[model samples]
Target: MTRGKLFEVAKELLNRELLDKDKCYMLDCHTEIFVWMGRCTSMTERKSSISATEDFLRNEGRSTSTHVTLLTEGLETARFKSNFVNWPKKEELKLYEEGRGKVAAMFKQHGYDVKELLEDDHEPLINCRGTIKVLQVNSGEAYLIPLPDQSKLFSGDCYIVQYTYPGKGRDENLFYAWFGRASQMEDRVDALSHMYAIADSTRGFPTLAQVYQDNEPEQFFSVFQTLIVFKGGKSSRYKKLIAETGMPDETFDETKTALFRVQGKNSNNMQAIQVDQVSSSLNSSYCYILQTGLSVFAWIGNLSSTEDHELLDRMIEIINPTWQPVSIREGSEPDIFWQALGGKTEYPKEKKVKQYIEGPHLFAVTLIEGRQRILKEIYNFTQGDLTTEDVLILDCQSELYVWIGRLSSVTSKEAHILGQKFLEMDILCEGLPQETPMYMVVEGQEPPFFTRHFSWDPSQAIMHGNSFERKLSLLKGGSQQSEVSVRNSWPAGSRGGTPEGSRRNSISSNGRAKSASPIPNVLGVISCTSENQLPYSPSPAEVKLFAGSSPQNGSSDDSLAFASSPALQPMVPPDNVRVDQVEGSDASDNLSIYPYERLKVRSVDPVTGIDITRREAYLSEEEFREIFGITKTAFYQLPKWRQNKLKMSLHLF
Candidate 1:
């Protein structure tokens, strides 16, 4: 679609690969329009923004007064760049442009105007407004007959319905032979042979299908205006008549359009309601199956979830099992889809509820001494505010997101169950409905919806800086600090997801500072990940993972709170390394407080492929390699259990 013609791509499907350096694209984000021109684009193509916008507006039935902005590669706005996944840094653009001067020259000579405009022909033979004829056959031969009133049929008869689209360049015929349940087999065989004979002579070979009684497909019911069944068979009342045509010239009729909503969370509760075919009736929280003429489309709403998708899939199997149905997600609807809904208009962007839409609220979920525990809200937060050890919740209006770091104690399962309860509690506590859509995303898999809240520098994608940072550090005579800073240096009021206290950040609104103070060692006595711990107080615990009346404080209960993985703590320094530089490292017992069971065990030799009693880690990677032999990458490729077991066996844990 990026080669020459303008087209829409699903927001979920948009990524860096779609932005080819040799092509151009226009993203229509409802109210706003952005035209992206690649670096190697031709001069003619570069100046075609106005024409493109006009064509786009005229096609989409939008006003010409709508704003259209132009953007070039590498100089795109933060909002534009956030639309894609794994969006490359500007340095990658520079590198690609470094060797493309000659390629640009060659492209300028020909330009994009020479490219062919591609389109598909959609004139279907099995349409309602086309020429339709019915044939009746006994044991001998099939003969033409007049259309029966209400498509009334007798149980003892066999019939062939032949559909043709005349004077539309689609001369081929569409044939369907329907056999009644009580009809004789010999009569049905004779009808099919006669139907194919006429079809071969008419237009070489035509599209044909077989339909049995009581097993009609959606197309069968939709193609025919009405259907009625009787209890009798062939009689003397049968008469042959001329073929019939209804409103042949009026091809695109809205009366033939049907819209069905495929909704609900599970099979037992799912419903497919036949709603009015209009933009106003469209819901953003459900998938809709629309039938425009013979074409079918599955319009996926933005607010619909994975469960809805599965329901839509089942609905599709019933509505258009064999036919090719166009699957289009919300915001990327095709022009034809808009045409079916009488041109795009205002529609709900999310599931409507009694509660008013509000800005996001964040919470941290942490594990206490290897036990999952709930933490409270974080004030004045930022992307750099999320720690590697704690699980954070981002309540984005109607949508909620729970982000788990790579080193967080909460596994995907634990997050799905407990993180959900925490989100529900947060919403219910605030007097809002608990039916808001929730999603649990892991580190690096952060969707654009979640990432857009941050005003991220492409260079700061990783914990460490890019090559530019390394070069800058070299020029500054290297950093004097021994340990790397856990958070990025950013001021309040900068970047999206600036946490709950947007303008009320700890530092002055305009001042530059790290997102928050780095996590404190707390005398190495604290074992949990949270630095700003809020009390659960004396509330009754919802989950019985730990047995006690109170959950805010640690108890002697041995039961695991959802999981057994230990909560990540601050980076531990070796005994020889001095830690006074870090806050609260002056304590005599600088080592983190570990469970008594771990300190008493002997070192485990996991690499030796032997099952032994666990002990304090003593083998270094060099000794591990000398003893067993496996590269770090290979070890990483092993199953997570193997990797975690190896790490636990080593003193590293």
Candidate 2:
């Protein structure tokens, strides 16, 4: 713990626990050496970090060209951050959210109508997938270097790498200002000036980020096929000799041996981050895919979920469709598998879950007028956060749900993908376990598990109940050739419990029962017989809602007399049909039975979400949508039970 000395606090795969703010340590990561100095460490340790790392590595018999990195406790680089199971990016994401929030608020203040933003002026982030350009500084000036291979880099000189996209003038491209280990102050100043100048040349659309040479983040390395760093750059005396002899251009078939750690669950948000193709890179808690020449090996960790097998299988289909993968369980690795991965060395054998740090966070994907979408953070995860137009991402720590709005655009269906991209680009979901579960919940199909996060009435939709059928049983109306019942297209599973309903479900290939989101109920059509059943009379509330007034003493047949109605006159009955009136019925009693012309028929199958628009046929489709504040198509798409409630709420029963 002393400032002048270097100590190894822990070895091999490291986690956040090893990063105490009170301690300073030298990390030996096989390929690279990093010195972590806590804020409380003495200035001597901070100043001697470079010397200490070199001296320590030399004494340990490591090579002279070993990648060296220096990191402060609070200001750790992305490379250092990704070593842990979950790295909380709360502060970073929060800052980005604040900036986005300000820009988004302007849109909201102006009514979210940004359709005027030229279509040519907008582009998706995917457009930023072009070549990466690297520039090295020489004598307070910068010049482009031959970087045909992304691995071309030297430690003696600072560089500015510009990652460009198709719409170079429309959006901001990322500018990485790299400060090399042996680079001088003049080199850094020149690189920075060039970075800003380059940004300005591109209409100031490129933002600069200062980075270290050997300690680039995972995102930084993703732009390159492989990174090969030389010991010295233009400033070193050996540079001429090295250039003349081509002494240290190390060569290896990087593609022949590669390993990628798979994080996040469900294929949509899953990320396969390439790690050093060594045994120590294997963490017991996560899954990995190894590539050996043309062979693909999916090493399933004992702690990995069944979904890992599926995700890996799908990944194989994408990455190496021609070759069949050899699936190896953690404890049952074959000799050939070990040979391909160098050797079966020591690794983290136990699955470790990080302790929960923050509560659930909610984010929304707001679609502006020009069909462009912006992901903004919501302050709270309440019922109001789930709007009909936005795709909301509810990050509930262990699980995540992408809530698709009923009226959301077709592009919004990709919320799962967009949400993950937003989190990845902003590094907001750093430190989160790679296998954290993510599921999509469409508007009406919200499962109880998803709905529980919001504040709303748990009262089940009344349409799903048999109350309507029960109501008919109390009447003298005939149903000889008819039967009224609910047909739920999808069962609304029990609250806080897995559904054991008779819905057809398939087990995952791994034989583990995967948890699923419950499907909401829908309405089905009812069948009727020759017997005439009395039609459902409008309720007092329904009368007030539709007619603008209720009948005087609405409970009595006399007061609700159809003959005196302003809208329509009562229909006349056939000769064979007899008019039956309740004799001396109480004034408080409603019309339970009525004599009608033929059989009055109206359908209400809210339980099984049937599209029985006939009940409200009197109103035009436009009027229905306008009055109820829901599109006709959207309303029809809802479960019969849900449709019933919405129609009932805005309408008369």
Candidate 3:
């Protein structure tokens, strides 16, 4: 689509009270179409067009005259109003017989102009070849005025006239034309004139590109500054406008240029500057200025006096000053301008991780690629022995690991880079031990079975292996030892290890499971027996089958370990039990377990986040009283600050 058509559609959409729901439609109909059409290459063009259209309509003034212009020859018989409804066909038309007469009539009745032509012997009106002009013809008067001479005018220079529109083709384009002084006019085909036509095609209203050219910079000067001022505020509207301008906020440096200044309170002698809606009644008046190629604000007056107008005049003088306007000075110290206003500690910035060899510190380095890997390989070479003595190897591959390991500490950032270096290699050609301690065999000693073939193969690293479980399996322990397990509560009396409260578990020949506790152990295994077996074997969907432990046979002569303790008695009857489907519960949960300290339970709190750990649950009255005893009377007697002090000292009590 032409820029004009797109603009027209945009204008119609923008004028309406856009609802939240209309945004998607706007993107689909307007934004996406322009992108698909390839009309909007950069954000600048679309943003500038939208802004110009909005501003043009917002600032549009009522026209003082109703007359319209038309271009035609000065022949009497050629003038008539019948041509308004139908035009003489282009190929078959004769000028005096139809075209000239029809166009002239409209000019006589209304007022029209021929911008660049005169009546001649051959044609009704013809001057320069292929040239158009503006004409002024009233019912009683007839004459034409040629376009002004601008051979010497410079680019960006413009003029407005009380001129009328020419004939049809001219009206389609020429909203306004710009011209340069003679020597600067570029070659005469009215290239400057085409700018206006381009601008006119854009819909809604004319923009700087349509109504004024870069040569006509004056038309934009005051309005341009005003646009920036309007956009330079903290409000959401101003923020959006600022974004539309494509100007970075950091570019508006205040140090070198006095673009903005805040006026003192009680300043009523201001000119056109508007007050911020939020604090309009404040004592000080804030005046913004665009003096040295940047935007800044200044406080113009105080409560005792009103000197706002005087200050504005002074500022304008600084900006425009003498009749010969000079270019504003650009800022030299870009670093200062770009520096954040509130000092360095403003936002969270990336930090380099640190690595340390000994103490409580442990770091992992993943090898990336490059010479860094070679350096890391050199360090791994000396892993056969580690001694307190410091050893130094200068870029040499021999005795590298022992020399580096002696260093007191290293930053995590260096370790991370080293890790990246390690990953860049192929096979197990080179390797370096991470800051994390790994058991290594001495040069002449036999390595343990578990460590026998452990190679530093980056490709074979397991991302989610349960190292704790693997290590637990490798640990030496008692014969017929119980598997490392986890329980909601202590396994009967194992917590404090009391005698009469001791818990006993029984195992049978088969791999059946059983748990009989006061609470039915919430979710624990049950052994299968012919006489006392559950009516049906628990399906996978029903009860979870645990590994390791089996059920005991019901023979009286047997140890009957399941009945050795009173605490093992089942508290809940089978009829009252409700079973939730084991949807995503992990089967690994029934495998080798972990110690209590390593286990975690999670509960959700809808409004907050997941509340884990048994300690988060509600406490009984006695428990609450026990916690409050330390603060009992002191909290009530203390002042608010002291109370806060005590509360913040959470562990001191």
Candidate 4:
């Protein structure tokens, strides 16, 4: 095989998000088959038939000059090799039939029951006969059904044999799920290479072959670059330019070289390289998934930047003027640098400031001090870290809470609930745990002191790490400590227990409070308790409707709870806006891509009622008031579906 072609093949394989090494080799082998074919095609007539090449391939171990082209994309190497292993010349069938006794004798030697043989699609030269029993396929790869006494083959070790004419389809090929052994495959591989050489000798290279061959291996197959198969546009012209310069020559004119667009797989905002960067092919798909998910959060700001710092400061100053900064750390390191009160002690040693990992960002708060403290204690106890995690509390209830935190090696169910909430809010969180581990080390000890990790609350050992647990002297609260339970501060209307609106909002990386409380009218925090009661609230329906599906799971919650509706949710003024400028018009004056899309509920009179099907079913708030009997003020204030409809329409447009 040409080293240049091998490098190209490797480059193509790397660009995929393949998870395992085996896939890499499989793809590599398949690429060799293609490359071999390419070499043969270079010397052939341009209009060679795919079938002629296929026939050459089937003439196993034979070398002859027969020019032809074959469409081989998407076929596994083993399968492709199998197709050529037993090529049947038209004269061979009569001879084989005459020696039926010999055929049955060979089958008996091979341990296959002669009775099991059956008729199959025939090649012109041989009346093929074989029985193919598909065993099973898991995760996409298929295996052959073994004899009653034998085990099925392992993944990547299986092969198939098939016969097909160029004009006829794959069905014409005599397909087999079982092969003789490894030695047989080696023979097949050699035959395939020779056949490809003969076939390609008659046909010429694809248009851009020269360009692909000329560049340096790294330039042609670098981790940071992508392999693009030009299908349309000025691709032919670009190929001509490359051919003129030769493959290895530098022909870097933008107009002449086909643009490498990130529009293909794993393209993230046009910057990501196209080919798989990792050696293993298994990670290829995930590369795309990860890029798409993270692109949404890529431009988010952290506290390190002056602008982000100012924004964070302004947010905290407006939202929690009374809140004090408490320095919490895991492993004696602060994951978050430059907290409101704490500064870095060591550079790279203590913590490195990165965008998402242990970085500070402005966020809304939901829980008060006590609940925040409890959640933090739980996080520390469960995660086994003492420094470098931050949290922001959003809102909480009896069973669930909403919060934000840095990724944890271990996360609570409570943390996952927060993750779900963040997902709802269009925030992507990675590494949130689903179930708590059985054993967690508290203050660096083994078994006896170990505590079962809880999703929302930390174990008893964790509480000991916090100052409150020390004061309460509840390190070993006997049965109370062992029971999975939540403690309520009993003084009614007092801030002792979770405040009236106090629920465990989320915490950051180290499980520290993300925000101090859920107080409304605060610029950066949500309210735990509202001063105004909701009006004419509709009772939640026992029967649930499929509101929407989560990306991971498409399940509908049968029991839904009512909290503050999106309409009741406070809307803060935009920190930035999009604008366009022209000679006559200032860019800053223009609105964003779609300014009309905003959430606003429209109400209509029951008597006049909207024609759900006609008359432009959706109504703006003003239209809602005009058509509905309700007053303008009431229309805007209406909650539930009315408010949700507005938010939906605005977001879509």
Candidate 5:
């Protein structure tokens, strides 16, 4: 009979539902037949073998039959006896004892103690109910060895064969020790084979071997502590394992009978093993052991559930080959593992403000009186250079004023850029309540050439101001003519000019100037008689007096002749002095030519009492108001002397 036939017979007998108590099972080796009772028992069974000729030699007197030969083998007698019996020569026995002692000493050095579970009274052979206890030397705790029932056993199963020497008690001769379930015997054998393969390589389990050689037993126990077992099934075995190992509750999945320990649960140190039944028909199972900290795996056969263990191990190995377990506090909550892996922090970054370059057309930013001011550099084309002019009017105020001369040198592109800059400056100064002011001054130029003023309009988001021509026409002496021209140029009912009734009468109905220094009478002159009567014409001597005294100089060469004239005597002082002498006369005294004096003046209308003169130079109401800081009513109420002073300041005299 072959070994395979013997294994088949053993399996069939062991799986039998019932057996006769009187029957017997036997295994036939070439030289003898090993026999055992058919019924199973809990006690240590004996190994009894009969000679091949014993059946024929049995006498008829024997009442009971010999054990049945259920299995057969074709091995040599001495080799078969050595396997089942424990008899050896003294020399070989000594060598065997020495090797056993050396192996036991090696186990002890690595934190493990080997102890026999069966006593001398029990036969240390096949079918014995004995085990071996592999205890932790320091803690004296047994390992949770896997069993056939998917449960764990504290002690490991041991198979020992003992021999009886002459006149001596039974002595142990041969022995074998193993951990894990009987069903997983093949896997254990495979694992040992793989370990041998590793030992044959250049680099073996050096760290594992060193622990034992160095006698560092305590450290060896730590390697087993990191081991976690996952028994796969529909039961709650994994939960039980977690509880027994004191693992975190989050590690186990009861439904899947799986266990997983991520980097940041209760602890970082962890290892795992999974045992699963793969084929019921073949009665075969698979076991996988994973060293998560080192990203190492050891297994045999295909696992039923590969999602949790196999893929994660492969991923970790690929992503972090040199990863080592982190030593975290026992009850700490898991931090995000990927963040640590990616070397990132939790805090956010700070935001920064935008910056821009300063240019000639750009505005200067300043804070004054708790208010922000965007001061622009305004060129005064009329004043030649802004630095030489008193353009910084009303200092120490919330509002900023800048005199920008006619931006003649500014290109369209520069203007556009400056406009955008000013817009941004306005946005920056949104905190300020008052608007900043920019003045475009063209001195001595009237109407369209008058100073253009601008103010930041927050609602519009643009610098808004009145046109230079329109504002000038609204303020100074020639406004009536400009208004007439504007009204005529526009279509009837157009939305232009002041409404007809809204125009203010500069002259009173009494045919006399309503205010002192009334809009300068460029077209006609009015003379008052001693009787307060209006004179239509002046005498020859009067014409000569006025002709000699040019409007520019306000002085006549024939002053003595004028003094002698009776008509002028009452109007002019006896000292040949004239009333309403131009204020700021000293400032204009050196002027040889006046641009405004060249303008052609038309005669005044007799019926309408309107001046038709086309005055070239003038100031607008807004300009006049800004210059003297006065309202129309206030200007009219001022004394003639002060009024003249303001008019000269405006260059309106």
Candidate 6:
């Protein structure tokens, strides 16, 4: 036979064997089989045919290759090598048949019925039983069911499978299926069997691949064309299916009329416009139902096509207006999906409060005072040393004082209500009884204690040490004698007492006081003699009589007698002693009899000669106000009593 005729013969044999046995095969079956044939067939037509036949039998491992060698000596021998070839044995054919039976049974198990076709018979075009029908493609008269509605069929399509269920009559059943694009009959059969197997395992048709392509258009756009599939019919159960698939409600007008555009990866801003209704080319001719009772169909081309609109209308009418197209934008809030998938949502932000005051008015008095008081109370109640520039003076109900100044220098007392600006001032002014006397000195005023009060005698002023001893002795009465009393009791001309010629020397020949002694102690002696002349020697008993009468315990007669004594008269410096020298000289250096000898003294007038060192003469609130020229309203506004208590508590009096 010719090479073409021999190839035809091989192809016919393969087709007949596969059709009869129903064995699954891979793609490129023709190429593989023919390529093998071409390799062994290059001799005479008959020998080539035989060689081709031998290779096929050997290739399938059903038989071995054969060889005959001739000898020149007439000793002929025929040997069968291990590569001997022969036709398929009965046992091999039986095994193939058995395998075919198992495959058919498996297809049935998966809800697909395999039907073989005869050479002269035409495969039915309509789905009468409404059951899944898989056409055996190897048969010469294999079925050629048209593509389902909206389903695109490319060239070389082989498998024509159907999914459907029985209804009231032959024409009333639903149908659906996938038209495969496999080129070879063997490949078509393999695909159909695999699809059924998947369906059995998944409990549904193998539509996952189709749905995946639909969702991921960007990835699969170049590989396959996308389509919008729909289905409808009486007794169709698709409500749950529609919802699960995220389809829009059937009541949507565009969905009912199929008035929409399907956006693909390459399309932009495709508008959904209404189109006139028309009949669908795929209606009734190419649809099916699965064992799952899902009636499905698809539109192969654009949804904007008139055929798709008509198909949508027909589906709506048949399915009682319950069939709907999927809405890409429909479903739970978009954020909900993102949240379910661990995405974040944006929310409004909160506002912040301001920190510092900026105007000349300072902070609001009420609020700032309240806050400051609370802070002060915390520190004060805890006895904490923490201090702040803001100060607050609070009683049981309200703040009596508030002040703010330089932050760094505020003392603990002022930290509660006053600022650092008052550090140099007497701001320790709280916690005293209301009856206590105090004063408030603001900026630009000196404390009353520091102000010079001219109503005192400098010449008669004694050192603090001597003054303290004198006061103590007077309080206890001179009957309790000590060294101080002995020193003061010495005769007038003694070393520690007034000198004999001091008074005579202080008086010049002009009868004016001579220049006072430069030594303050000698000057004191002169001042004393100039004021009073004591008896040349005063005995201890006389000294006791003079010093024993104290204001606290002395009888009025004793006070009168002591006041009348010349020794008790206020001392006056001689006229020659410069007043300015006495006032400006460091009294501490001259009065070195005390431990605090460096302390300065405030000069006093000779006439009044008040002992300003006495606590009783310290400035009172009324006296302070008078001295500083402060108003009553302003003075009372402060916590005057508390201020005094704080100063006293701090030993700052």
Q: Report the number of the highest-lDDT candidate.
A: 1
Clashes of each: 9, 18, 69, 68, 7, 34
lDDT of each: 0.50, 0.48, 0.24, 0.24, 0.25, 0.25
Better of 3 and 5 by lDDT: 5
Against the hidden true structure, what lDDT does model 6 obtain? 0.25
lDDT of 1 by residue, 373-437 (tens): 54545545566555444577776545566777655545554554544455444322333234344
**Candidates arranged by TM-score, highest first:** 1, 2, 4, 5, 6, 3
True-structure RMSD, every candidate:
25.5, 26.3, 39.2, 36.0, 51.7, 53.0
Number of the candidate with higher TM-score, 4 or 6: 4
lDDT of candidate 1 at residue 503, scale 0 to 100:
36
- Deviation from native of the Cα of residue 381 in model 1, angstroms: 1.7
TM-score of each: 0.29, 0.28, 0.12, 0.16, 0.14, 0.12
Compared to the true structure, candidate 2 yields what TM-score?
A: 0.28
**Residue 346 alpha-carbon offset, candidate 3, angstroms:** 42
lDDT of 6 by residue, 111-216 (tens): 3212211112122222223334433233323444344432223222333333443221211111112332223334344444544443444321112111111122
Candidate 1 Cα RMSD (Å): 25.5
**Model 5 TM-score, all chains together:** 0.14
- Candidate 3 regions with alpha-carbon error over 4 angstroms: 1-261, 264-625, 628-653
The TM-score of predicted model 6 comes to 0.12
Q: Model 3 lDDT vs. the true structure?
A: 0.24
* Per-residue lDDT of candidate 5, residues 569-603 (tens digit): 11111221222323232323343332332322322
Ten residues in sequence with the least summed lDDT for candidate 5:
204-213
lDDT score at residue 231, model 1, on the 0-100 scale: 35
What's model 1's lDDT at 195?
Answer: 66
